[model samples]
Structure formats: C-alpha cells, structure tokens
Target chain A: MTTMTSNALCFGDEFPASGAPCFVQVDGDGLTITVESEGDDGAGEAVPFSALTVSAGGLDHDHLVVKWTRVQGERTLYLKSPDVIRAFRETVPNHLSLPFAQAAEQVQQVRHRRRLVWSLVSGAILAMVLGLWFGSDLFVELAVSWIPVEWEQKLGESAYRDFLSHQEVMKEGPAVTALGEMTHRLTEQIPNNPYRFEVTVVKSDVVNAFALPGGYVVVFTGLMKKAESGEEVAGVLSHELNHVLQRHGLERIVKSLGLLTVAAIVLGNQQGLVGMMNQLGVELLTLKFGREQETEADLTGLQLLQRAKIDPSGMIRFFERLSEKDQGRMEWLSTHPMSTARAERLKAELAALPKKSPEPFTFEWKQVQTSLGSQPVAAP
Target chain B: MKSEILYPGAFPMVRVDLAAGEHIKAESGAMVACSPTIDIESKMEGGFLGALSRKFLTGEKFFFQTLRASRGPGEVLLAPTVPGEIVILELDGVNEYMVQKDGFLAGADGILIESKMQSLSRGLLGGEGFFILKISGKGMLALNSFGAIHKIELKPDQEYIVDNSHLVAWSSTTSYSIEKATSGWVASFTSGEGFVCRFRGPGLVYIQSRNPGSFGAWIRQFIPVSE
Candidate 1:
C-alpha cells in the first residue's frame, strides 16, 4: 500500500514554545513521525496506536489532537487537515479509533439531551398556562360565593346611583309605575331572596335594560314602547332580576378586577374592597356577562315567570322579535347577543314546565307606551 | 512596577511599588492605602462604550482606579472587596485568560481587559453568565477569589470537571462545556450540584474552594427579616 503522509505539528516538552513541523505516516501497528529538515531526514519517533489518546482541540474544535507519553514528558500531535484525519481513522486499529467513536457519541448525546430539555421546559410552561386559565375560573366562582349580599347591595347601590346620574328617570309616570308593577311580580316569585328589589324606568330609546348586583334594575322607555303587553315588559324584568338573583353582575366585577381583588376580599381588606367598588361603579354599566351567564339568566328567568304565574311566551316572543331586527343601535341586543338558539332553548324549557293559566297585569300597555311622549307607537 | 501579595491566604492584599511614571490599574475601590507621591485617577478603560459594555454586560465596574507614581517611587496597597486569597498570573502576550466577574484585583499597564460574550449554552448553564472579562497582552495580573484559589494544570487531551460556581478563571486555550453534575438529571439536582463545567485541557484552570452563592444562602437564615 502507498504510504499516506500528512503534515503535522508535534509538541514535546523540549520544544515548549513552538511545536516542530513533521511528516506523519501510518506504519505497521503504529505511526512514525519524521521531523522535517533540509537535505537530511532526522531519526523519527515511532508511537504505537495503543499508547495514543485522541481528542478534538482548537478554538473551533475542528483539529484532531493525538496525545501520548514520552520519557521527557507528554507529547501532542495536532492535525488540522480533514484528509489526514480521514486517513488516520481509516488506517488506525479498532482500539485506537474507539476514542474518536466515543467522542462522536458524546456529541450526539449532548444534542439529544438539549432537545429533551427544551421540550420538557416548553411542556411545563404550557401546562402552567392551562392550569392558571381553568383554575382562575374556579377561583372566581369560589370567591363570588363567599361575598355577602350586604356588600353586594352596597356595591349595586353605588353603581345604580352612578348609572341614573346621567339618565332622565321617570319616577312617578305611567312608565315607572308599569316597571314597578313588573318588578313586584318578578320579586314576589323569587323565594328566600336576599335582595329588596329597586327598579327604575330610564327615558331612552335604546330598547335596553340591565340589572346590577343586589336587585338594582333599570328599564328604558323604548322597551315599554316596543312591548305590546305588560307580560312582555315583565319578561325583560324577569331576565334582569334573575341576573341579580344569580349574582352574575358581581361575578363579572370579580373576574374583571382579577384575583388580587378577590384575595383582598377573602383576606378581609374592607377598605381596599370599598375603593375597588367605587372605581368599578361606572364600569359596571358596560360590563358584558359571559355567554354561560346569559344562558343561565335566560332559563332561570323563564322559570321565575312561570312560578309567578305570568306568561313565559312573552319572554320568548320579545327575544325573537329583537333578534329579527337590524342589530345596530340596539344596545340590549348588542350586550345580550340575540341568537335564535336562545329563543328556541327558552321555548323548550317553557314546554317542559307543567301547564298553567298565567295571570294578567292591571296596567294598560298602550297608555304606558304613550306616557313617554316621544311618539304614538304601534303595538308589536 | 513590582508587586507582592501580603497576608497570602486570608484577607490578602497586593502591595505594589511603582517607580516614577509607572502605573497600575486596579478595580475601583480596591485601594486600601497609598503614598502621597502616588496620584490616583479613575479611568474609563477602553473609552466610554468599552467601559459601559464591561460594566453592564460583564457586571464589572465602569471605572478602573489608575495609581501612578508621578512624583517618585511610591507603594500602594490594594485589596479585594471579599476576604479571600489572591493569585498573580503572568501573561506572555500570546495566551489570553477568561476571568470571572469581580476576579480582577489589579494589573500592570500592559494588560488589556475587555468584555467577551460567551456562547448561549455557556452563558445560560455555565454559571459565568453571558459576558466574562477577557484579559490579554503581556503583564502581571492579580486575581482575587472568594476563597482559596486552587490551580489545576492538565496535560494534552486530559479532562477535569469543576463546579460552575467555584470557577475563578481559566486559560483561553482550555475548552469547556456545561453539563449535568450527575448522569441522571434528578440525581444531579438532588446532589446539590446541578451543573458542572467539564474542561478539556492543554491549559490551566483556577477554581475557588468556596462558593459565594451557597455561603450567602447559609448566612441568610441567621439574619432577621423586617416586615
């Protein structure tokens, strides 16, 4: 076989400052290194394959370094050429190639381990995010249950006053009396209710009504104009009142303000709780209930109407009529996402209830609508 | 300038005797005492940006106190903030040294200190952070350790594993990578040695006997916390 010769730098104890340039070639069972000289070949050192240990060196870790012991001290041969490394690996005995094999395996293992660590870390973060998402919902529910009705009344009272501050409220008109009559019917139906219901009829044409926590309900004059009967108006009242009964408004506040505020309430920080309530009082008007809360309020409101012996069909008819109209400028439809599915679900619940003849209210629906003085409206 | 370490092991100080017009740079606030002939000036080494990078990236001080014997030969004593041993490394203008933060106590005028960014793995897991101080050029450099400094000289292709937190400084020729202390990950953490630096050497590595992080944690339990 042709001698595979390559240029190499040999470092020894004698030449510590700089290594000597030499030619390395594979010999029988070992390697022979010949020091380069002019016109003369110096006697070279013969190193057995068994005596050498191979490792990677250099700043970029591309150079192949072979180290062995000599009588003077330890010697190192640095080889940078890929050709030389290939030749060395091809010619060296299996035992000598073992170190190179092990080094390559080590690199593979490190890469694999890093990949494993990255995936594990990412998985942990994902799990934490999911846990916090679901856990916080449960936490909000638990916190809402602990809140006293008295505190809710105070919270609702402040928000109620803030809401009515800008609106023209019809305190003693036929519209206000009609709303009071509806409120009384709904409140009387709720058993063991902690709230003393306070309903107001605000003068606006937005066909909207909302309930604050602890029985503070507001009905717009446009809604009375839109209704054909007192039971239809009472349907809206029943829905809003159930929002207070189920404490949906309070749930929205607690969820929006976040867990820190809930923790403060749990820890009995009354002053901080009061401060948060005052700040959130105006925000309560625009707070939108979640889809689940809306559905719960809808179904429970039907049950409340049924228990009070008022017609449950009126609530479904009002919802269906609102849903059919162009939703723009309809604040109630916008806040309460009017869907055909909701009307169908209400109809299904009404069918499930035992049949009863509903009691009619004593107010004239047309007179209540005309009392607002904006226009003489047609019966829906 | 000539220098010697007095009180070698514990509470060590480097006493430097500088000839006229000779100067040495030390970590700011390192000077304990100095003669009247020695003029001290705080210098932003390597100009503004260099000093800023070293200060912010490597956690080194922005200013280096330059003590010059302007009038005549004067003696100045310098000590590190932490009570520990001091080592003097003689650079040959060829090899560079990677020093940990707070390791530099004092150095001759010929030595150049600059911040170097380590690789991501070395930065995140090696415990040396992202930036380390690179000392180069020919000069005598004084390094202070949090505890006694132990030097390990390795032969070609030889290897040694060192706890990351105990590392003080190492020759740039020495290659190292951070790895788990034990074969098993759980065992590595349970052993209280999470990551260690495995160094492949044809050079020297210096490590401290004590870990400052563990010492601080141990001392924290005794201190009373105010509400």
Candidate 2:
C-alpha cells in the first residue's frame, strides 16, 4: 500500500501509467481510508470510480477524506462529499466499491426474504394455537350468552334437520310426491354438485327457512303458502343457500372441535380430545356463529338472490310478515329471533339494490296457492 | 325430420320460415312443466387423484338430468335445487331472443348448449378445454358422425371397457367401475396407459374423441424426457 496525501490527489487526476496496478492509503487530519484496484467493465480502460468506503469515528471530524488505490489504465476519477461521509460513517457501514457492494446487496436481500418467511410461519403457528385455545363450547357460550336467548336458539340448531323432523307427520302417500318434486327441483338447481342439497318442506305454519351443513335446506310449508310468488320462494331459498355457502354449520363444528382440542391439551390426555368432541353433539346445539358471520351470510345471500334475479326485497317483506304474524308469540321469539330492527335493516339493504320489475309470465299461482292446503299451526 | 324442442320458461314461437300452415312439433310450456335434459360427463385432464376424488364425490355414471323450463325467462336454468338464473343468448338466427345470463348464445329452435359450455368452461378453467359437456337430445343425435346407428347392449353383469376421455354420455342409473392392467410394479408405474373405465348394466355410452393421453403423446411427436 502506498500512502497518498489528500492534497497530492486531485478529484480529476489522470492515471499514473497504463496497465500498472497500485493501492493507496490516506491519513488526513484524523480520518483514514484504504482502497485497491478490482477490474474493468471490459471497455478497454479502467472503469470510473463508483463509490467510496469509509470507517469513521466521532460526530465531528476534520474533513470528509477518502483515499484510493490507483490502477493505471486510461483516465479515472474520484468523488467526495465531506459532510455526508462523516455522518454516514458514524450511522451506517462504510461504502464499498462496486463488486463488493453488489455482493453485500444480494446478501441483504436473501437475509430479508428469510426473515419474512420465518415471520409468516410463526404467525401461522400462533394462529393455529390460538384457534385451538379460544375455540370451545364453554367459551362460546360465555361469549354468545350476551346475544338474545331466543335468537341464539333458532340459528343454533340445524335448520334443515329440524325441518325434516317436523315433516315426519306429513309423510303419508302423495305428500312424498311434493317432497320428491321439491327435491328434484332443488337437484336441478345445483347440478354437478356431488353433495346433494336436499330441500324438505315442514308442515308448520311458521314463516321460516333454515340451512344445514353438507348441503341441506328446509322451508316451512307455511312460509311457502305465504310466499306471494315463486320469486319470494327463490329469495328465501337464496338466503338459506347463503348460510350453507358461508358454512355456518361447519363453522360451529370447527369451533366445537377446536374447543375440545384445547380442553384436551389443557387437561393433557390423548383420549381427552376425542371424548370431548364425542360429547359435543349436545353441547354444540347451543352454539351459534358470531354476529359477524351472520352479517356476512346476509350480504352473500343477497348477492346470490340478485344473481339468481330474484327480488331481494321479498326477504324483507317476508321478515315483516313473519314479525306481524307472530306479534304475540314471544316464546316463539326465543327460538325465531324476529325483531323490528332486523326487519328495518333488511329493508334498508333491499332499498339499496337496483330495482327491477319481475318479468311478466303466465302463472299457475292459484294452483300453487291451493296446493298449500290448510294452514297448519306453528309447531309447538 | 322429427325434432323435440324444449323451451325452459315461457312459450315463445317463431313463424318457422315455412308456410303459415306448416308447423313443427316441439315441447313448449313454462320451465316448470318442460325443461331440457342435461347430460354432463367430466374426466380429469390429468389422472389418479382426479379419478379417485371423482369416484367418491361425483356420481358414478354421467350426470343425466331432465330440466323443464321454470317460471323464469325461457333461458336455460341451472341449480334447480336452490336457484340459478337462466342463460339467455343472442345469435345470428337467434338474435331476437333475450339473453338473461352473460354467457350462452341462442340457436334455431332452442338455445345452444355447446357454445355456452365452451364459454363457461373457458371462464371457469382459465382457457382449459371443457372436460364437461352439456348436450341436448337433438345435439346428441345431430353431432354424431355415423348416418346409421345400432344400439349395443351390455348384459347386467357384463363390463365394457372404454377410455375416460372418449366417453360422451352414459345412463345415470349405470354403475361405473375402473379396470387396470396388472403390468407389475415398475411397468405400471412408468406406463400411464394401463387404466380404463368399466361400465356395468345396460346403458348407451357414446365415444367421440380418441384416448386423450395417446392424442397428447402423438401430437408432441417426440418424448420430452427422451429429448
């Protein structure tokens, strides 16, 4: 290394000789720098100086000094920023020439990517752990108890199964034809679906529809009789379909499973998880997906109705009709959970959608209405 | 020529380009009463997991469907179990028809299922060719190459072997089974051609395209692995 004084080396100095290589060191008023020649950019001359590397001390220094080792081959120049050099040296690593600088840059990028991947993995693990922790029936009950008791009961049970059980009394002869027809119609709606979505009508006078997991939907025949047109039925069916798509039942199942898993882990036994889940059938009956999940289903259901070209406002109208019909049935309210507020909200949503008139069609409306037969009382 | 045309929703009639007294007989009514039959057949573009998953989840035979027009538009309706919109189309001869769904084009006498199938498959699979087909009765009859047809019956317990790719349609009531050659461990593992679909019971199965794997192999003209 040859010591080159700051004064001896000008900013725009010429090469000492062609094809000669040299190293330079600078010690200027408490600053030190060393540099060596690398290679060429293949343009038949020494490449111009790109960056400077400096190891510095103290906040205040004499001059921002840099020393360079000169490789003599054609013209070359050096640049210096006194103020930046001093401050940056204190705060950051000293700058390096191109080749070493490129390697460092690449290493930094690799390190950053590794850190990101690790963080994502850790976050996923944490989420799984927490899901297993908080997902419990006891915990869910404590959380859900704040909801109205009646609202929780109706939404909590498998609506499709409940509808089927209620239909058991109406199972004689030709009623099965209507059921078969309804099933056939539903089957047409969901072609290519391996998981058949069974549609069953319960002979109850309650204006209600419910969806079950693994593709099941139930509509009360009372509700069907009240439906002014097929569009209204379509609207109600779309809502139940939304519940299925949103997997409200599946969510409850997973939550119950998660709770049991956590309980087993806490209790620390291999069979503990299995035992809790097996016992969960009764416990899960009380659990409901959160309010957010319900609202999401409402929005999704509305979209499905819109896509199906059925009038979404029919849902609001149906809700209002149900509310009016059951004005005295507060005990039923505990199960059905009808409120003026919900009706108003649903109405508002309907109002927000674009209005389209139902297409004109020759109707067998009278025949359909007459087929409803006598209006049965709501199931006790 | 005898033809059966089904209108899914409303009964719309055209003058038939023939004399006023000359009329063609076709099924017309609300979709509630008269819907077209749907025959869907799908196979994996690739194998193994597809065949297994399909065996468990999908119906064994082709999806044999009978659809009647509903109270909605005369457009073809999907998802009768829940609710789906009618797919209406506008075509050269069928330009006067109202289109409700975004895809589908109307054809003479009835809406065309193939063009709609192509468009829907393209949209859903991001340009992959349709492995699933929705064919009407007239389409099934007209699209075949042979002028004369003879029905071949399979005995109740007998099995008929056919390539999965070439199967056009089959009865929904029939049971589907898979037959594979015992080429021994390594040979079976290396050669993908040993597996075939077996059909049981009496049902008509239509075969159109050649074995998809063989066709793909023949088209490349050279083995990529060998190259």
Candidate 3:
C-alpha cells in the first residue's frame, strides 16, 4: 500500500488587505472552488460535507462556508473542496512553500536590471566612438582657430613659399605663352571678376588639366593632343576657367588645408602645412567631382557656351564622343569620365537654350595647337 | 586656351579656372561662356580627404540652370573636361567626316574608310582614343582594346565570339552571350581568362586593346569583389 503524503498550498505574498482576498485551486473530477474571506480570519475551519457543496465551499450561496478565528499570531488559509483537502493531506509536502515563488520573482528583477545597465554602457561606448570619428577634426579646427592670429598667417605664408619652390620643375614655353594669352582673353570676356586670371601650361604630357585658386589654369601637353580643334580645346579650358570663376578651386584648397590648420595649432610646426599641400595634390588627382558638381558644370558650362555663342551643342556632342571612346577605359572614366547620357542631357539643354550669336572674337587656336608640335608630345 | 566669339555674334568663350571666393559679375548683355571643366592636378599639392571632399563638393550641377543677362538666355556656360575628349560631327550624306576632335574643330575631312586594315592599325596601335566609325550605308561602330575585329555575317542561325569591349556597335537584331572563358582544367591553365562576351552571326564587331584601360577596369572592380 502506498503511504499518504501531504502537500501545502501557497498563496504567494500577502497584500495590504485592501479588498476581499480569494483562493482558487482545482479538485479532482471536473470540480473547482473559489473562496472569498476577510483578513480578520474569523472564518472557522472548513468541514467537508458533500461533493457538490464542498466543491463550492465559501462560494457565497448554496456552498460550504467555513470560518476560523485567529488571535494575533497565526496565519489562516481557506479551503473549500474535499478533494483539495485530501490531495493536500495525501501528496503535498509542508516544505512546498510560497517563499520559493517570491525568491524566483526577485531573480527575474535582478536580470532585468542587469540588461538595462549593459545596454546603457554599450550605448555610451558607441556614442564616444562616433564622436571621436566625425567630430575630432572639427574640434581640432575650432581649437586651432583660437590660437593667436599671427600663428595662422605664419603657417599659411610658409606653405605658400614652399608651394612655389616645389613647382620649380615646371617651365614656361609656347604652350604656357598660349595659355596666358587665353587667360587674358577669358578675363576680358568675363570682365567683372575681382581676382586676375592666370593660365599655366606644364611641359609634362600626363593628359591632365587642373584649375587653381588665385585664377590659375594648368594644362598638360598630353591633354592637348586629345583635342582636335579650338572648340574642343577651348571647351576644356573654359570648363576649368569656370571652376576658377566659380571659386571652386579655392574651396578645395581651403578644405584640404583644414586639417593642417588644426594641426598647426597643436604642434606649431611649419612642416604640417607642407604635408597638407602635398596630400592635397594626391587627393586632387583621384578626386571625381560629385554628380551635382558635374551636372552644374555641365549646366554652367553650357550657359557659358551659349552666352559665348560657341554652339553649346558642341559640349554635348563632345561628351558623347568621349563616352564612346572611353567605353573600354571605364576605370579612367570612373575617375574622370562622363557618360553619353550626360552629353545627351547637355545637348538637350543646349538645344533648349535660346541661341544667340556674339561679337566675333578670334581664337588663335592654330598657334596653341601648333605650339605642342615643337615640344615632344609625352604619354598621357 | 583660346578665345573666340563662335559664329557671327555668340558670347565670348573664355578658358580659365575660377578659384574659390571668386565671382564673375555678369554684364547686362554678355553671352554665356564655354570652357573646360576645372582640373586640380596642376594646381594643388596634395590629395587629402578634405581636399577630395571639397573638389567633389564644389562642382555645380542642375537639371536646367539658366544664366540671364537682362536679355533672356544670353549667358550659357559649357564646361567639359580633358584626358577626356568631346567631338560633335555633322553628317553630310554617305561620307563620314571628322568634325571636332576633343573640343576643337578638326579642319581636314579625312576619308571614311571601312577596311578592317585601317581598323586594325588604329584600334591596335592606339592612334586615336577609340574610333567612332559612323558607316554611311550601315551604322555606328565602337572599337575596343587590342583584339580581333570580328564580322559576323549570317542568313539566320550562326555563332561568333565577341568580347563586350570589342563590341563596337550592334544592330538591334543580334543575340549575345556572356560566358566563362573555359571549363575544367583548361580554365586553370589560361591566365586571366573568364567571362568572355559571345554573340551570334549577322553583326559587325570592333576590337581594340585587350585589357581595358584604368578607367574601364575600375568600374567592374567592385562587382567581382562583391560576388
């Protein structure tokens, strides 16, 4: 025969006794009991009577009612079902207690707190990392600006002096002479600029061209051969001049030197500026104008051509030719490339632009294109 | 650089680079300016991130920006870059003629030749950047880096191999293929061999250099790495 074991029912934790407390538990054979009682424990010990009434013990109507009185120290529990009493007496152990449930709830609360703390700590770390990445240079720039004004000037002067010395390798020649002439013509055409325009053509044939702040336009011999006529050549030159007139070149220079400006304040060194300039040159070689910049140049250059009355359609046509030619050289195109679509778009604009002829200005391009003939053309 | 009032009375074309903090004041009736895009290689000394950001940032772009000089549409700007070339040609009947080389006008009307010999000499030798062969009776053709210029003649149902770069220009009536260069051990034996573009007959192909120049290669660089 199996020996009977007793089980104790738990009522979790005690409340402040704001309302009537109830206890619920299931008894064998499709039966349930819900007892409502007062905190005073005046209810007497419940007695088992019949299966139906005992199942509804203390249920308020036609159900078993039990009452017990407590003086001041004893805890009271209300039971209504006979099966619950039998199960408690036969199987549930007295050690089976509600304190264990309270302990588990405490454990869950601690875990939640730990998760919150971890999240906050990680978030702080992420903020610090992002701040260091994007804001450090800005902070440095601000700091450098606060230094004595004289220091900034001295640094700029030193950099300028060094820049002049570094360019000693470049020589003046027929191409240079032609470029200078072109610059003069350009400045005269667009007469209202405050700064004077200067054009410099380097002897190297790297097929490259660039515009500098202070109105400098540089063209390499290699790029000259790439052009077949004065219009194409002029188109290339005018584009750079547009950058100068638009002050885009200076903006680039300023941005390049921004880091050095900050570095100067910290180290107070003359070398930083030189380093910055050298670094800026490399960046320029690979720098691809953003889509917007390219689009603006296309639009602006088209306008320049229209105003100049040089057939802005030629610009779009030129772009189409380049795109067709450079299909195999996409890497170069990626770095310094334009698409047929871009050209087509420009053509559309040129076509849309009101066509007007301007007073004749002579393009002595023969002299310029021929100038490169004497100097051995170099590889682009 | 040169200045010319193109046609009888167009605006003056000025070739100069405009620096930052620089502005050109437009007169009441001045026309637009046509010039090349800005080149920074000859100007600045270094290539820093800040410089790069600024170079890209300074470019002007718009879907349609108009420059007004009191008189409507008097000022229009056109800026194209070099190391890159732009040519605008006029088609006169069946004869193909060269109009503008780069952005300048080419004086002589060179004979339009259809001979593969000429294509071979020009395409392989790297004379002109790339030939834009505008055939009188046929269509336009683009040559690629050094390779064979294949001509696919078919009366429906034939095959041919054509590298994508070598695909000068094609008639709309042609099916194409992009496939691996080899299969099995043969693939390993061939160096730099894979993904050759193929095509069927009834088309013309122009071939130039085998290896795409720096620019072309870079465009596909990211794709293979990602794959």
Query: For residues A188-278, could you state the per-residue lDDT of candidate 1 as single tens digits?
Result: 8788989999988888888888899888889888877777678888888898888899899888888887646645643556787667656
lDDT of 3 by residue, A76-151 (tens): 2334345654554343333332432343345455446555765686689998899768876455445444444344
Ranking by TM-score: 1, 3, 2
Error of 1 at B170 (Å): 1.2
Candidate 1: lDDT of A15?
51
Worst 10 residues of 3 chain B by lDDT: B99-108
The model with the greatest lDDT is 1
* TM score of chain A per candidate: 0.63, 0.45, 0.48
Candidate 1 lDDT over B1-227, as tens digits, reads: 78899988979999999999999999999999999999999999999999999999998999999999999999999999998999998775545678998799999999999998676688799888878988977778999999899998755556999999999998765689889999999999999999999998666788999999999999999999999
Question: Once model 3 is optimally superposed onto the true structure by TM-score, how far is the C-alpha of residue B100 displaced, in angstroms?
Answer: 80
DockQ of 2: 0.00
The candidate with the higher TM-score, 1 or 2, is 1
TM-score of 2: 0.32
Cα displacement (angstroms), candidate 3, residue A84, comes to: 37
Relative to the true interface, what fraction of contacts does candidate 2 keep? Answer: 0.00
TM-score of each: 0.59, 0.32, 0.33
Cα error, candidate 3, residue A22 (Å): 26
Per DockQ, the best of the predicted structures is 1
- lDDT string for model 2 (A1-380, tens) is 23432221112123221111222222222222222233222222222223343221110111222333445421221212344343333434333434334544554554566567667866999987887587554456454333332322323333434435536434533333444543444345443543456566667766556666656666666666666655556656766666665556655654555444433433545476445433543454344556666666666666656554556776666555656764432332343465787667676776787776644223444455566684433333
